[model samples]
Target: MFDKIYDVIVVGAGHAGGEAAAAAANMGSSTLLITMNLQNIGQMSCNPAMGGIAKGQIVREIDALGGYSGIISDETAIQFKMLNKSKGPAMWSPRVQSDRMRFSEEWRLKLERTPNLDFYQEMVGGIVVEDGKIVGVKTSLGLTARGKTVVLTNGTFLNGLIHIGDKQFGGGRAGERASTGITKELTDLGFETGRMKTGTPPRVDGRSLDFSKMEVQPGDVDPEKFSYSSSTKPLTKQRDCHLSYTSPQVHEMLKEGFDRSPMFNGSIKSIGPRYCPSIEDKINRFADKDRHQLFVEPEGWNTVEYYINGFSTSLPEDIQFRALREVAGFEQVKFFRPGYAIEYDYFPPTQLKHTLETKLVSGLFFAGQINGTTGYEEAASQGLMAGINAALLVQEKDPFILKRNEAYIGVLVDDLITKGTEEPYRMFTSRAEYRTLLRQDNADFRLTPKGYDLGLASEERLREMEIKQKKSDAFVGFFTNTSVPPEVLNPILESKDSALVTQSDKMIRPFSRPNITMDDMRKIETVEAFIRENELDTEVLQQAEIQIKYAGYIEKEKNNAEKLNRLEGIKIPENFDYTRLKSLSYEATEKLSKIRPVTVSQASRISGVSPNDISVLLVYMGR
Candidate 1:
């Protein structure tokens, strides 16, 4: 029995739950983390990797905002890569393949070490609600634990149904029991719920595969980590992942089990991730293609288990193994288990505010898969924000909300609350309009101060951010003021195939040329001497160079963001009756009423709300 009322009660122990508990407790709130099994605290259920494309930017943002995901990822990474290195700095993303067991172990250890946090092993069957407000949780053991606020991060567990071939069972994950009561309880309490499906590739024994026929995909020569904190060690030695393909014969073998496949046989009705489709779905959709690529990834540093990426299916075990044998490297592969698909319950996110708290229920919040989000990074970021807001609500402080131009976290939350995802939502670089200003390299600059003010991010992080800011500004100022003679700079520019300067000019003028880099500038004795005198680190130098090179585009984006921010500043009353406005279109009124957008900017983003409607509303508000 629990006596003392906790400030926060976090349900589930996946990425979202872990972060929620850590954040709330670290911010001086008493938090309780209830999970069915603590062993799977931060288990990489889908893949043993973290960060890819825009997802990497989100992890860095999470770290910059004092979240533990990046630090845990770096500490356990077996391979490191900076994706999109050939592209602009805004596109560069840091990713790492983690040791599965170590990733979970590190998360559990970190949680145990956190202050004002306690852990319990139990299935949270229902919540204790009183007058539209959450007061506590009731476990399967018939015991009740009291809390001031509750955060539900029950990832893919509520009323979960797992499908393998024609066989169907109720389970949250592989070999895990399904969670019950909470979904029904919430639905009864006037919440709208829907179903979503996600799957994973089969785990295979690494020794059974033949690497000689596959192409090696090694980690970057100069590995970068996810966390900026000193707690994580840099990766020096990295394991290699292999690339293989499934031929037409393999596709035919997989198709043979189409009759028994859960996805095609109508056993699973929920929508899976659009971007990451199943193998059968891929083959069915792209019938003209002959081969599909698969990445053979290791599970950990010590384990013999390997994840068969891009081979996700819900076909029969025999069909899965038979088809896998036809692949290049998996000629004699052995499977640890057959891949399966699971459909779980999720609530429509439109019912929630940007703070992730339900409009129908006070002192309660939803995050992660429960909010219809798919990736670990997305879930972790939501958990971080939800946890911070939950703590702030208890302490009688304003809710912490980030703007779209400020961080990727802001863009994600805004997109969710405004547009409401139909399928599982995943992050992409294209989603953030202000991507240049929201680059991973400058996450600390954009968010560390806010995190520090929230009492979650340490003073040390703020200090590091301040130092980097000063050094980068000084480096940029030096380039603007310092002039280099043609004799000294022309040779370096010519070597880079850039036009030679005709006269002594400002160093920044020549540095702006395409293919020219800070390293090229450093070849000049004066620039080199200036860099030496400043003692600028690689990060600072990179920041300064990007600023000078992309100054025009950056300034343009800033102006656009500022203009849009004015609309965001125009607050809409929470109880505004959109139906009363006869001038607004019926569809716009319906959507606006349902979404109940908190700002004019959010209303403008809704699908049915037109630009004209925004103009009308602006005029009506006397703007």
Candidate 2:
């Protein structure tokens, strides 16, 4: 039914596809977003939550880079929390418990309003290739839509198979049919495929729960959102979640279904997330531990459905209910839907370039679970990058590739394309090497400019950032130039467990500490007045403090990054044969030939490529 050639076409409307479509369309590309079911756009398949640890930093980066994930999350969140608040600035991450239905609704509406984006409700079965390049897609309905570039974000939907106990069905998620054709076509086209499994816990009815017997977990009194847009407000009232624990008795009851469990039986074979294991797996792995904590989270503000976190299992319904009742507060638990495992197709990301385009197929890109990533943040970040680069390819512009030091998205994509995950990869703070420079609070500081330059971030955003930067600089200058009297500063410093300043020494050094607050600065009317007059956000103030306090470390990291950049700047030819290099070890040669890293710096970071091998290669190149 269509004859127009679009600039970008995105298949699937999950977090990754949604962000990809929005980004490319917003950047002035004529984009068409085709999905199996438009109503389920942005459906949170596994959980009704967003952002945690390093994942939260990614959402903030997405926000600063003109993606709508954070904005929609903020608009639909039931409760908000800043995780790891007690830790360093690098560790602080913003998390939200969302109203699932509203989240999907908000995302659909946002996409509808976005210019240059067209929505089509249908499942794409295969891509149309011409002269070794992807030129369009073919849907299940037998219609072909042409596009300059296509981004495939088919999240857990391609030839999906769901297993509950012994029963199996074709579905991307519970109650949703699995997509076919694309995986088979791609495989036939010489692309390698692998299977990955992810599971969701049972949804329990909140109305039947006994709150009096459970410990209440509430949101912060003053809830903070993740979006830069002020269109969405923080929740005034939030539902309280309950905490429960799995006991030995519950473990014993779950084991009864071992013979029927699809995971244990030869019915299904695929690797799942290592971090988030099912209750049965947890019990079997940690046999010594008597209990495992489970959180009873609400699925939405209006719905009575509750997600039984940490209680994920592929056990039968009867066994699930019996085991759940034995837990602390789930005595009257009512299940909305039983938990099950879903196996779907994914291509090893090693076959794709750092730009997310497959090395085997030109103009074809894969992201999200299709690339073997597990979280919404991981998927969304990949979607943004892929969409941006796809649109850039259409415009004949240079690719937009972020380095490990630039953004967490960079580190995430780098890790996947380099290492090639054998299991579902989830984002963790520990995974990032330069996390100290990649704080969520300063995501806008690091990426807004890039987004603005890319035409995704609006001029207003750049203007506002410029204003904030100037104000912060002025404030820092004042802090450095203006000195506090020893009499005035001594008492404050002493109270804060800091040594008293002598004469007119600057309070900037001591003021940078975490314990130092605006209340302490009230002693000096000037600092307080400046802060009050500027209406500075606590996050901005905290970022400024970190900038001053860790100035030395930040500078050192910049220098190191610059040195690394020199090696990264030295581009390697695409057809360069590592096997021909006699100076490289066999192992290094094998690894380098496989990954085919674009830079000497990336080659050095490859697991099997040693520094000595890199040195030898560098000498051979006369560098």
- Local distance difference test, each candidate: 0.93, 0.88
lDDT of 1 at 566: 94
Report per-prediction Cα RMSD to one decimal.
0.9, 1.5
Q: Name the best candidate (by lDDT).
A: 1
Worst 10 residues of 1 by lDDT: 224-233
Cα error, candidate 1, residue 190 (Å)? 0.8
Best by TM-score: 1
What TM-score, to 2 decimals, does candidate 1 have?
Answer: 0.99
lDDT tens per residue, model 2, 1-623: 77699999999999999999999999899999999999999999888999988999999899988899998998888888888978777899899998999999999999999999999998899999998899999988899999999999999999999988889999999998999999888998889899999898999888888877778889888888897654567778887777878888988999899888987887778998999998878988999998999998998888999998898888777888888998877888888889999999999998899999998889999999999999999999999999999999999999999998999999999899888899999988898878888888778888999999999988887777776777777777767777788887788888889766778777676677667765677678777888888887665566667777777778887888888889998878888888778988999999889889998888888888888999987876679
Error in Å for residue 476 of model 1: 0.8
